[model samples]
Target: MTDTRVAVIGGGVIGLSIAYHLAEAGVETTLLERGALGSGASRATADVVRSYFAGNPVSSALAVRSLEAYRAFPVRPGTDLPLRQVGYLVLFSAPEQVAAFEADLPAQRRAGVDVRLIGVEEARERNPLLGDLPLLAAAWSPQAYVSDTAAIVTAYAEAARRSGATLLTGRPVSRIDSAAGRVFTEDGGELTAEAVICAAGAWSPALVRGAGVDLPMTAPIEQELLVTDPLPPGTPEIPCTLHAASGLLSRTRGDRLLVGMGYPGPDREAWRREVAERFAETYPGLAELDLHPAVTGLRDASPDRRAFIGHLPGPPAFLYATGFSGHGLCNAPAAGELVRDLYLDQDPGIDMTAFAVGRQRTG
Candidate 1:
């Protein structure tokens, strides 16, 4: 039995971030990935970095703290992550949503999000490209920003390696015998560690089951993304804009425009087509532009659509950090800090009771 202090399963952003934190804290850590790091939903993410959640205090608070951690990373100034502090503009296409947006503003302000509810004329002035679309109202938060998730994950992996964490790739964990303190790999290798963390994203439920725990999680309704060919020169750099009417969000990424839409079920291919069709309808400006092929990937989801984090119920040494739904990209840094605290028995800085794995479920 190869004795390691901690074993982290899954090499997505959440796992890599936690591994980096553990190694930085002087823990002996080994990260096992079924595939290359950042190859899963982490890379497929739309990179929406915002804290303007409605009616979810835990999520809003997490986003607030996580945004701070994200801004503290050296990757912002010197690395390729290109963390840009472009604000988010949530537009309401329907008149009824105006009140909903207004109702959400006070809570957003309470969470310390720099959000302001503005009139339709002000919203159009903010984005001239929005053009004659009859928007009733909008909310703008200057604190919101987007990051290069691929670069962020790479930074975590490199930082973890530098801090002495061993990263193993191409090794799918087949069986997790937590009672024996050993995880068996498909290639017949066994990893023995004092503690094990499951960060397997959409595949987390199966991994937990292998270890004799039934987690209340499911394969997420896959999200779809489309990238447009670079916009014509002189087009305004659009802040991340969300159309509440259709659940479509669009942002500027270098020269190309990145657009995303939420899907309803497990059919990834169907969702991609739906998003592409909706994108054209929602933004008539993009009606002529040829939308690049759609790409679909799974986001680990919980029944309540919040993350499932904290120690697992069956084993004291096993932990869970999965089910970020589709917001893992923005929450990665905060997750790292939380996991580090959990492993070290330190106070988690933020109250994460709502994200606990054993929380009472109504549905």
Candidate 2:
């Protein structure tokens, strides 16, 4: 069996970030990916980066930190990532939805986020493509942006390799002998380390279960559709906007608009048609836009909708850094730092109890 200081499973944005941080800190790290690097959720993401969580302070703080890292990509990863500051707009139709955001507005402001609760008129001004809907209020975060996720992942991988981290692709981890700090790959390869990190994205639940840890995680298939923008050229482009009541997510990509909605059940066709209908209703002005078939991918989420970023209960050597739900790309940089600090027994400088494994879920 090969030996290393730490063995990180998965090669998505989160895994790559973890490996980069650990290696940069002078640790001997090895990363294993079942497919090519960024072949999973990282590649399938919507690529919108925003730091607006209605109620969760922990997630917002992590996102702010990660945004800083993204802003400093040239210095941190030594590669320039394509980022467009298109901003994020969340339209709320219900009073309850507006109240929830108003309650958390203070915390977000204290975190140095320039988020504002604006009236529907201002919201429509920010996104001219907004239709005449019953928008009670909107949360506008001007610092939010759209990023090139694949480029970011590649930059992290390059930085990690430069820092002496070994990344092994096509190595599907079969099981983790966590008690012994050993990882068994499906291709009959074994690697022993002082610690094993499970950052396997949607596959994290099963991987940790094999180590006898029942991680509370769910893998839900989220879908996104690409549609042509039939609006006039003089019309303003739309930011990443979400209809809070309907769970509809829409953002612009050059001349096209990418739209999707988070569905609770397993019916793919039903979800697709529902999202299409919602899109048509929401953007009545874009009636002529051609709606393409949705591209579906799995996202892992916890019961509390927060990521578990600390070590396992019984086996301290086995750590988890998964379940970012739909926010992995936006929160990956801080996640890498948190995992690195946890492995090195250093303070991550934030209240991590909210992200602790087996924490009681209230939200």
Candidate that scores best on TM-score: 2
Q: After superposition, how far is residue 178 of candidate 2 from its true place, in Å?
A: 0.7
Q: RMSD of candidate 2 to the true fold? A: 2.1
State the lDDT of candidate 1 residue by residue for 1-363, as single tens digits.
Answer: 447989999999999989999998999999999888987788777776788675555667678877877777765322445667778888887867777767766777777777888888877777666746667788787877877787788888988998899999998988787776688899999898888898988888887876666778865555567888778887778888888777888888778788877764656567667776777776667666656744666678887668888774334388879888877877777888898898788899766677876676532
lDDT of 2 by residue, 189-303 (tens): 9999888999998888888876677777765555445555455676677888989888888888766787777753667667767777788778888866767753556577887
TM-score of 1: 0.90
Candidate 2: segments with Cα more than 4 A from true spot:
229-232, 312-316, 361-363
Per-model RMSD to reference = 2.7, 2.1
The count of backbone overlaps in candidate 2 is 0
Clashing pairs in 2: none
Q: After best superposition, candidate 1 residue 15: deviation in angstroms?
A: 0.4
